[model samples]
Target: MLKIKKKFGIDELVNLTSILAILFLAAAVVLPHVRAFRYFALIPWLRGIGLGGLFVFLILQAWIHRKKVSELFGHRRARSGANSALQIVLFLGLLVVLNSIAAGHRGRLDLTSGRDFSLAEQTKKIVKNLKTDVLVTSYFKETNPSSMRARELWKEYSYLSPRLKYRQVDPDKDRARAIQAGVKRYGVSVIEAEGRKVEIEGTSEGEFTGGIIKATRGEQKVVLFLEGHGEASPNSQDQENGGGLSTAKEAIEKQNYRVEPLSLIAHPQVPASASLLVVAGPKKALLKEEVSAIASFVERGGKVLLLLSPQVKTGLEQWLKSYGITPDDNLVLDYKQHYFVDASAPLINRYPFHSITQNLPDSFFPAARSLSADRKMPEGVSAAPLLETSDSSWGETNLLSRNLEYNEGQDKKGPLTLAYAVDVEKKEKRQKTRLVLFGNARFASDGAFTAVGNGDLFLASLNWLAEDEDLIAIPPKPPGPQPLVFSNGQMMQVFYAVMSLPAFLLFFGGLVWWKRRRS
Candidate 1:
């Protein structure tokens, strides 16, 4: 051992120990950033052990060969110190230049679990193909956290294209500008392009991208709602009792749609410029002339949406029968307690392969009925189901009973349809008339519109009725909160390694020295 030590001098040993110390220190600094370290419980302990071993090696090398190290580097210590200081100054200057260059050019590494800070694919597709400049104005208060997040989000869009730019205006400071721009609340985003503008109150990637699509469209679609039959009123602000559809109207308007209340009693026929007509939850039966006008509209290849509540005697049942759709007069009850909030609200997650219901989230309909559609079709008419209840659900026949149970012959079995879409071919015209029927109108009421995915479902149905299936239902993704988790055993391991190792080392060394002195 002495001969080997002579061959490999103290200088070589010191160099080797210094390299090991640097490697261990680098591992200790870099391991926490790794994704695998979060799942692997032993990585932190290993890092701590490496750091402790490096500290021990450094102290032992310094103490054993203190004279040799002093002779090697201390003779010209002033010159060495001067060179090190100059090198550190040069390194700092280089780092500053690099930082300035990096600041001017935008480059982001979205390390979040959901990539929440990055732009979505749908947003990139719209921004990258911009032919005109899009000016996005944000109305926010500088003191709010939403203002900071909105600024961060708009930067992602701006980085994608030069034609896209954003400006932030504090609503409190600039009250006139806010009123002029029609800013209703904080964090409202107004997107303008080609002399058109859209105001969106949501900050999701999908909402902003949808606003861009609406502002840049060539033409707007019009959706007319029928009134005067004791149906749900659009002008009413009362949310409960299913008296208002204001939230549904706002959702449709966000897609560049023009929504207006129409009455067939005043007009002889449906308006020629109408793209889609809606009959929402009529409480009274339609008169003969009004029914004839609606029939004429459908006969001439028009699109229509009908929402009927349970047990309402809307006299158009026979006409719907001709199209092979039957709106049942029973209540839908689901025994799946986990899927519904109560027995009245049936949750639906299953859907057919249709453009309207594709990729839709789970929807909950409170006090809804069911529809019936057979495999047999009418001549040149095609019909399909949109939403259906689970196998644990059934239609209750006796509404008067306190404890509702399915009767063998009277009540219907599971998997009942709640909505249906029907398409009819016109013999003389090139266009097809489309009809969508939902058994529940309360789903779109202002009070229950945002219950679950009910808002997206409502918008998607409107898009299908207006023949704008391309923009069915694109919703935003929000980031979820992440919590810190550690087990008691893991915490104990960490404490022993970080707090106890050095104390143990000192005690062991002291015991050895005391024994040697006694000998």
Candidate 2:
């Protein structure tokens, strides 16, 4: 003990104290992220005591070198050099501190022409008003482009509110943890809140932000799609036949809704928890019992969405007529403004002032039919057109005709109804039944849903029907348009200007130097 005490002199003590002070300060900066460091008993004590000991050692060292310190201070060169060093140190220190504060309280400016880098207002509102903390963990390979893109996008979420925290994990380096988290593939993310988790497989803003919303919102409302009469399957991937509604299903799921195939033939009654029932593009006629079950469900204040294709016999004429809704059998033809390939695929840019169609873009309907409401509607039932075609469009009587033309007396007039929203209320009861009818289901199918505002329009309709009006109006921010292509001659001019300017300057400089040396 005497030898050890002799070896640990004042000079050695000062060095040890200085080193300890640096370590403790580093721990203070790093502990928040490490989390487990706080459990160490020595860290808290070291933070307070280490810094104090450093100050004491500094004072003692100064006292021991009093004469030398006074001589150094008196020398003009030494004082000037010390002042210069101090000024540099102070300037660097200020820079570091300002940088840290700026990073912590930074505001993001999305200067992209389309505001593509910014989150939607709806998403910002949701994240800002979150009641619980939502953690978004991205599982991706370090070298993946999607990982970088995801990091850039999720930065907005982290900056929007304190409740949202974004984290990225290298799945390859942390294989065990990634597997435990159920991340089987790269470029996927997991959002967790309140013990509930939602996995997003896509990197689009719609998918990731939707997952955050789903995870934060605890309960999932069931959206049942009617099956059994050869309607488009939600699970189908056949894009050409319009047999898939995967895109529509995903959009609804993002809004904290669950999509399930519901068959009235298999089940006697609609599930009590069914938020909305969708009957989309049924080719075969529904059984009488199935129709009865749907009627019962609607009578009990259930919401319904009916998407009928042109000339498809579903045998719901009487059932629809009871609600003062008429589904026309004629085919919708847009000769003036239609998809390039077919005139039957009408391009509809007109929308009425309704919640479902508000802020929606032009939607293309392939093989669309027309809808008409009774002039005298039922007592408690009110109807309004949600989407419609222009005055140039007409409901053609013959869909089989290769050279189609509007028949004078047999076909419906121009400006036909393509979609309608209806509200049915009972006077004595508080229950109300809501319904939406779309002339064409193919537009909302997987193949065409992402085109224009088809997905947005469908989501809005579902939100209104489910009484979730708050989630209705948010639209996806598409990326900016591609830059203009330059011709080879134009490119050559740019190349020559960039490459020759510096060379020309260097040549002129060398010539001037040569002339001066010769002179």
Candidate 3:
């Protein structure tokens, strides 16, 4: 080692000092203009300074020993440079691979285990049919989890189509811009496309996507409220006194649908724009011409919503037979103890397993009647039950008489069908015509509109009729109470015991066994 030190020279020190000075000058001149490079310049400056100082110390040590500087570091300089270059290349390669994977999979990877991908099909359909550029600006509160979820969902939208642009706007930070854009709620998405805009409130990506589809789709949907048969009318005195037509009309209008009153007898032809015809609780029977016109409308791919009551006449029942839907004259009576409200009264409590009622709560039905499928079902028509009475229910055949008490064998035992949805295929055009025949229309009346999922059921049926069932809003789960208060000390103790007892036992037992073994 002493013989090697004798070969180190003074010229190496001068070269190292020159390199350090040049690196410092480059860092000082370039760092101020380039933000990214400023951070990187520090690394080279520190290396130059550190290596330069070491070289100077080595030269001093060599001078004290009367040795040449080249003998000390000449052989190691080339190896050190090669090793550092290789390490830097390895780091850069790793960084590029990791960044590429992250960019490709960022939005696709969901950290939320409970995320739903069921609406991906519908989302894809909208994306593939995009005619023009669409911008989705999401307004969210910075601290809200729903805001984060909305961003994640928007990322999926962007991933699906390059035409769609997703932007996040914080209402708190960008107050003036948010106000000008008319964002009322946190986590609301405003979709703008083709000179049109739609504001979608709530935190549902499915609903927001549906709103975009509806806004872009040029055809206007018209929901006709059937009148002139003592049916509830949107502008009628009956609604002012407590009818459902006005409420239902308002709800439908909010969804960008036009509402109109149509009397088949008054104007025999169903309007071309009519997507759905609602016959809500008609007290009178339809005339022959009216019945024929409705049948023609159905044959021409028009949707019909027939909401019947126990008061429906015989002529209407015979007319409904053309579509294979038979509304029973008998009123349903539930004997189940678990049924909501008075079980003895004509109230429906249980709903059948169908799209409309699948996830609905146990809905209450006031004065509900029974419906059945006739053997006269049209060819290629599919029927599904929407609502039914429990097995403990009986349909009182003599609807005129209000006698509740009856022998077990005297009454028809359920599950009795109360509402049936039929999708009839048109022979001429091969288009599916939807018909919903409900035994009790009063469930949708103003009197019982809010009875559990009554309004939701009505909305779902209308959407189904229009072949826009995916637009129906799924009711959000009720939020649990926050900062749950323990009412009593005993309750608090019980809660702690239930939550921590097993963990405490396991931990203490393990600790005791470890301590004993060590002892």
Candidate 4:
């Protein structure tokens, strides 16, 4: 008893206090929300006491072991050990800084073959450019696949814009909130903005994003497709026959635009509320009255989209010339840019930076005609090329030739313009008139609308004409099958790997401490 009392002196007492202080500090951090600690209000005091006690104990221990401590560090190997300790501290600090930054920016890469977890381009644009606060509340059952899925999507949406706020609640536990949000069942997402609310039932990209659009964009604009001259029908659902513009219409409507067919023979004039006038490959020629009415529509500061084909006349060529746009009678042939063995189906990868073609990918126009703008434009009218052929393509005037090569003088040189955008400002009326002329109407037809960038081009052009360029980007794609399942063997392997690693690290650390103490 006397020997033990002698060994457990003030030095041992101080050492025990220091260790207790460290354990208390760790408990304060790890058990921050413990009811007992909070009731006693020891969290803040615990940290301060731990720090003070550690400082005092360190000072006393250094004084008691002053000679031994000095001798320990005097050796070159001991100094190297001190340097290694400093490097470890610095590395830990760097890791803390990185984790802090990562917490601020919640981002992750979605590595899936179908990009199943990624937000659509159009959705990204809308959220990033949010003008007002949007709150998206998700109602999904806990442990449901949809709950996890919506959370992953909300993480991305929240990262995009600070204005977009997301909240997830278990439908069963939060029944009161769910009922208030009109979420009768799970998988409903309520989006509220500007005193308006929209509910989305499922994870459909179209519905989810379309709700945001409606909440942001209040009033919808009308897009009128001219029909009397046998224009391509926007209501056509026949993808097999390539008869309808159904795909094109669906894309346009997704941007919150209303599409309807207009006939000059029935209505005799464009509606005053018509936001855009589309003439999609008018097979028959327009009557003189119809042509006059179309001109009047353009003069009244309305937008017009003309999709013409080679050698096809809508009787608007002379009228188009007045606006510095002429649909050339020659066929456009791109030997360099066209698809395999089909020189006429030119794959246009190049684009000028206009709102219509900004970020637009490669688009193909099948059996397209060439268009030209006069070197000097009409007064107050500006012309810009939206789509063009490569320098290897030319305008072949001899449409009768089946087997063809470029003719030097008889045919126009390569790099002919296939599409032109004309902007006319009527200063007297304080109104602006926009025109988007494409030499090929087939590009916007049903079968071809799904081609790469083809649908984006059509939708973008309409948005530009309507002066709603905010709604332009690649539209969202429907979610695909996403299943993450593991077998028993894989689960066991993962479990053991996760469990064994920390145990191994802790064991290794203890062994190192024991060896150092023994030394």
Q: Pick the candidate with the highest TM-score.
A: 4
Q: Which 10-residue window in model 4 sums to the lowest lDDT?
A: 32-41
Superior by lDDT: candidate 1 or candidate 3: 1
Residue 161, candidate 3: alpha-carbon lDDT = 62
What tens digits encode model 4's per-residue C-alpha lDDT throughout 464-510?
A: 89998887887776444423323233456678999999999999999
- The 10-residue segment of model 3 with minimum total lDDT is 478-487
Candidate 2 runs further than 4 Å off: 1-115, 120-122, 139-147, 168-188, 199-202, 399-403, 407-409, 474-519
Better of 2 and 3 by TM-score: 2
Which scores greater on TM-score, model 1 or model 3?
A: 1
| Per-residue alpha-carbon lDDT of candidate 3 for residues 1-519, written as tens digits (9 for 90 to 100) | 455454446676655666665666465456534423324324444444544454465556656555444454456886587678769967975775565445444445545422244334446656646777778888888898888878876776766665677778899999998989977667778888887888887666546666667667656699898888777676643433345566566556645678888877767888877887888777887888887787777777888998776756935676677667777667677655322345533444466667666555445555667787866567878788887666667777765566675456666677888789887875666777788888776667665454456666787788778877564554322223212212133355677889898989999999999999999
TM-score attained by model 4? 0.74
Q: On a 0 to 1 TM-score scale, where does candidate 2 land against the true structure?
A: 0.67
**For model 2, which pairs clash?**
none
C-alpha lDDT values of all predictions: 0.76, 0.80, 0.67, 0.80
- Positional deviation of residue 191's Cα in model 4 after best superposition, in angstroms: 1.2
